[model samples]
Target: MVDLPGFKTFGAASMSDSHLAEVTGVSSNPGQLRGRLYLPPSLQRGAPLVVALHGCTQTAAGYDRGTGWSTLAEREGFALLLPEQARGNNPNGCFNWFTPGDIARCGGEAESIAAMVEAVVAEHSLDRARVFVTGLSAGGAMTAVMLATYPELFAGGAIIGGLPYGRASGVPEALAAMRAPSGNATELAQAVRSASAGYRGSWPSVSVWHGAADHTVAVANMDATTAQWLGVHGLDPAACSTEHGAGWTHRTWRGADGRIAVEERRIAGMGHGVPIDPSGSDRLGVAGPFMLDVALSSTAEIARSWGLVAAAEVRREPAEAPVRRRLVPEVMPANDTAAPPASAATSGVGQVIEDALRAAGLMR
Candidate 1:
């Protein structure tokens, strides 16, 4: 593995660490990664499971603490799987999202995580159909890898400040792509298609979150990632209905059946980090570096989107149906047609800046 000098994880120390148990008996860990788990005291049979990946320089425990995922899992009664990276694998403690072997199907880090998920489900009798994944920064990119390589395993996924799958294969390419992501919708969709070997199974729904003012990873990646999934689902890019909320722009695209297949949220004036509500009765996640207090909780919003939160716990007015425009008419053989859905921090230049800082005795 190529080591990028001075690349460090900048997640601030969390207030309190969550209780996480190490997972054992995982079959064939080719990635040689560590696994941590959080199971509620009272887990129902066939409960849901969520696999969360941590960004570079962050640990499973630290991620759980900062994101409040474990706390939410305990309340929602779902199991949590957190895959940790060893220093030997990547000096910066980042998942090798850009590496070919690590992200490949049935191999390397991807397979190790898959095996961990399999073991957890079998041991806890968790529901396989409801499995979901989400990550931030490098972890977010890895989330795309999982969805592309193991499409059948996840019902849905959320990517926060991440890149699309198959965007880079080496360190140099990764850095360039991070600074300026390149790929038309068709090209991006083809990359996923090539990775999965033309698997025709039902595709997982996608949720994308990004910061408009993020200097680490450019916001253009959000648009690219969205286009990639839109092409994958065969949805019209122009059919989206946008909602303007306070400090954010929410956009949604629906499938033929009218279910939301893709959703994007761009937080105004926010930097590269997961948005959280630090002071609220319904708050989730602690505010820290890369964990900003944007008065909006991505953790809660994601859980609600995935139906993990109880209806009573969510206090919101009913949403009027999104206004969608079908620009193209579908005439499928005059019969029937159906469609399905769908970085990290500073990649590239982020590494350059870190290196300069370290060289100048500005950063350790």
Candidate 2:
């Protein structure tokens, strides 16, 4: 039972309401790892779970605040788990995705994260089969690590502004590849396919999001990553093409493997930030549109395509009726004129959860 430094907890009763809390003693790695849990309006057993990972220099709260995932979770009736990186474990407060030891099975960051997931599931009523993971930058890198190492555990993953891990060729090469700019789509694709082979079950569907102008991660990497998945699934890499939007450009790859599918999104004119919040704070670096939207939509699509959710059931209900509760007061900003500082730096996870709950009308 690891105790966090300044943990807090709060909740509301409406089915559309959300609960905020600084969960401590949740990570098995005491003193080294801790996480913040965002419970949505409904916690009936078997609810979906989405584990949101943060980038370097970003806390769990900061990530939640910057991205507004808790709000989405509340509206969609899912649990959002934000795991914190202890300073002792990661000096920059970033997950050690580049380190071979960290990426290995049941050790380093992987073990700590897996333990956190287990703890959350054991303590809460999370639907084990519907579990998903997504992240940005370094966090995105970690998300890729989880998919490769624990393919059996995750239903799907969304990688934004990040790249795949270098193969067992060696740590130096892997680290270099991880840090290198995105280019050579063929190599990137090969790496993903090779790494994914280690998984015990069917490969999980993946959605990759990258920015065209992302100087940090490089836009080329997106193509390479997508090609790799296409190759592995026996799909034509050349078949993938680009789609332009007013402010974004999306690249997609669609293929079927029994129940799983693969897809990707590349945002144009975007930097190394989440896609949805174009003007997001510098703490997590530059962001484009909300990546959460992409994540949720992709998740929902995969659920339906893979039969995790019945298409008829989701389509039968009207959006208005499904919104059982609304917490309008909680969402209105204290001052509409002033922009809140990016929540990733000064605020705690509790504050992010609160904002999400309020934004979704799940809190008062």
> Model 2, residue 305: what's the lDDT?
45
Residue 263, candidate 1: alpha-carbon lDDT: 91
lDDT of 2 by residue, 164-194 (tens): 6543233344334443534355665566555
TM-score of 2: 0.66
Q: How far off is model 1, as Cα RMSD?
A: 11.8
Q: How would you encode candidate 1's per-residue C-alpha lDDT over 1-364 as one tens digit per residue?
A: 3233323333434533447788988987999999999999978999999999987667887777767888899888999999998878876677888789999887899999989988998888999999999998788888999888888889889999898999888866676667678889999998888888678988888999998877667788899889989988999999999876546778899998888888998877776667777565555776555676766778888888888985445332223422122211111112223212103334586666664333212224
- Best candidate according to lDDT: 1
The 0-to-1 C-alpha lDDT of every candidate, in the order given, reads 0.77, 0.57
Q: Among all windows of ten consecutive residues in candidate 1, which has the lowest summed lDDT?
A: 325-334
Worst 10 residues of 2 by lDDT: 323-332
Which runs of model 2 end up more than 4 angstroms from their true locations?
1-27, 167-175, 178-198, 257-260, 277-364
